[model samples]
Target: MLKLFFRHKWGPALLILLLAALVFFYNLGDISLWDPDEPRGAVIAHEMLQRGDWIHLSYNGHPVTDNPALVKPPLYYWSIALFSALQGHVDEFSARLPSALAGITTAILVFFLGARIFGTKTGFLGGLIFISNHMLFEQARSAEIDMTLTFLITAALFLFYHCYHEHYRPGWLYPAYAALGLAVLAKGPVGVIVPLMIAFLYLLARRDLKAIGKIKLPAGLLIILAVASPWFILEGRAFGAEFFFRQNFERFFHAFDHIQPWYYYFVKLPIHFLPWTLLLPAAVAYWFRRRKEKNPGRTFLLIWFIATFVFFSLSQSKRSLYIVPLYPALSLLVAEALERISSEQNLASLLPWIRGGAAFFALLLVTAGGTAAWLAATRFHDLARPVALLVAAALAGAALLYRMIRKGEGRGIVTAFLVCAFGLELLMAGVVYPSIDVKSRSS
Candidate 1:
């Protein structure tokens, strides 16, 4: 039994899932729903349930049908309402449970997508990277629409890749379109916009505008309209078509709120990517080296990243969660690159890249742990132990990973980095989270 558990094809995926569950679900409801978004989302659903009118939602007894501003779409609240109804309450656990479940399912889907397209190793790494990511950890545990929206977007992309790119199965596009339709319901227009951007640009990059002709457009549209139109019809009459405009167009150009500079996402992306962000250089180097190849999979991932980045950059209303849709693409790109580092045999080809990754990861962990130390020593003096211990772990990880890299042990270096990521999480759980709780309560 133990051997099967360890040696199964999905062994790594299952293990990473366990870790992800621990990270995302262990104390999901222990912390109160964060004000504004979390609580607001919860109330919208709970109120809808009480009124037995799922189509229209209200908050604090006022209509929240405006979209992208005072109100959000009903899909997320509907989901929360269903989960809360099942669990017999609208408390924290039931409210946040759906997002956490979606997060886990998304991670699993990442594994499946990677394994199908790249290899099992890439799948395992991709799943691990997706779950261990800085933003996924936070978003998964929170009762917010962004994570659920991310799941739908990612599912659509994966289905598209499977049906259009790999298998030539037209049936897959139906589900893919359905996923996009659901994504549109989950958020607003951005859901459909993201898929269109990725699918169109990827085909355009291949210089085949007619490639879209192969998709089941009529059937796909039917699926989309069937799944998505009902809510819009109801909500449009309840609110107005202007709500849709505000959710989509206004957010793009006007920046009524969530205003940030054009470069805001550029600065914030790497931080959300966290530990794996250290591997971006290696990923880029691989992309350059393989640029001559005609690999459609790699081309698709690159297009996914580039198109999403450019699209979000154009939007005047920017928030860190806006990039959640892009994380799966980032995961696949980094996983494919990391798999190369693990498997490549050419020292000269691999040395410079590995050296950069190793050095960056070591320095990153040390700097993060050191920053925690400084904060705990001075500003956060009461939370010194976890931060200081994290510093020690970071130093230890640096020494070990650097040594492994020098020895040409690519896998060992990755393992050491994973260890350090866990160390950081531990410190956050021990020191940072408690500090936040106390501060929240006092305030």
Candidate 2:
């Protein structure tokens, strides 16, 4: 069975899409729209439909008088409104469908990007890691701009990386620019800025200054302007500089909301990254050890992750999801690290730490499961069934992870970890989140 799957050309990608669909789409509408952001996005999309105005964003059918609705661009709302129109009403599933589809598409993009940079197996692992993580899955299930923005950014980077490797093919760069344009349409300048920064940083790291000319900045900028400028131009004509200067630029330098210390992302990133975070330290060490070598894949990925991390950390306004675009880099890095570590040559050196990390993660799952089960049994009887399902999945997966590591099944070890993590995510989606959603509303 495994041999047949390995031989098939489309097998890994199909598997990834299937798993992503299962996790992202399951119980999608079972919960109500989350307060604040989710409902804000859904309502704006709903109003867009009702008023038949695709350009001007509003809430509750009233024109947004504050500042031209600059908090987020209209693309995401446009997506939601389209989905809602298809479904004949604005419900949670339609509102959130774009994000879910983005998440799935991003997973497939990771597969191709990883394959191009790393190898086929590593690409497969990267795709699985992309979707199974806490941050991606959670965002995929929500009606928010971040996931959509993340997809656009990832798509742009993937195209950029393609152009980079294909000797800066002029034709390939156009789609990348278009993606960035849509990204800007989705969330504003940050979308364009983030990809450009990463590309510039990657080139700088490579010491390939001359390659900059081949990127055709003039043509690319025109494409971006052609796709992105129309909306911004109209927006400026209507509302002037307040939306552009204040909402896009000023918020970064001096945040009026969600202000946090510089180290905010440093603390939350680990929780957001979840099970994969356990292997991150070793992955960083692995890259550092190979830093002197001429490895563009690792070099680009390291810069991609670190540069984005520093960028978000430096922002005066901070949110954990702001850094979602960088998560794909981490996934690819971890996948490459695992591929290397799973080999017999490196397995002995890294196996102990990997085993310990696995054991500790499993212990966390067991503990969290037990606590949730106890709470469900005592204080929240409504959550009893879901809690039992979560606990059972956790316990069973934890045991499997421990056993797989204990047996020292090198390649199987990586497979085991992915399976266990994916199972946990499935249970979390199908049972845990909906249960908590119900409990929260009742409380």
Whole-model lDDT values for every prediction? 0.79, 0.83
After superposing all C-alphas onto the true structure, candidate 2 shows an RMSD in angstroms of: 1.8
TM-score of each: 0.91, 0.95
Off by over 4 Å in 2: 1-4, 7-9, 67-70, 236-240, 344-347
Q: What lDDT would candidate 1 get against the real structure? A: 0.79
Q: Residue 53, candidate 1: how far off, in angstroms?
A: 2.2
* Steric collisions counted per model: 0, 0
Candidate 2 lDDT over residue span 65-96, tens digit each: 46444356778888999999998889999988
Clashes of 1: 0
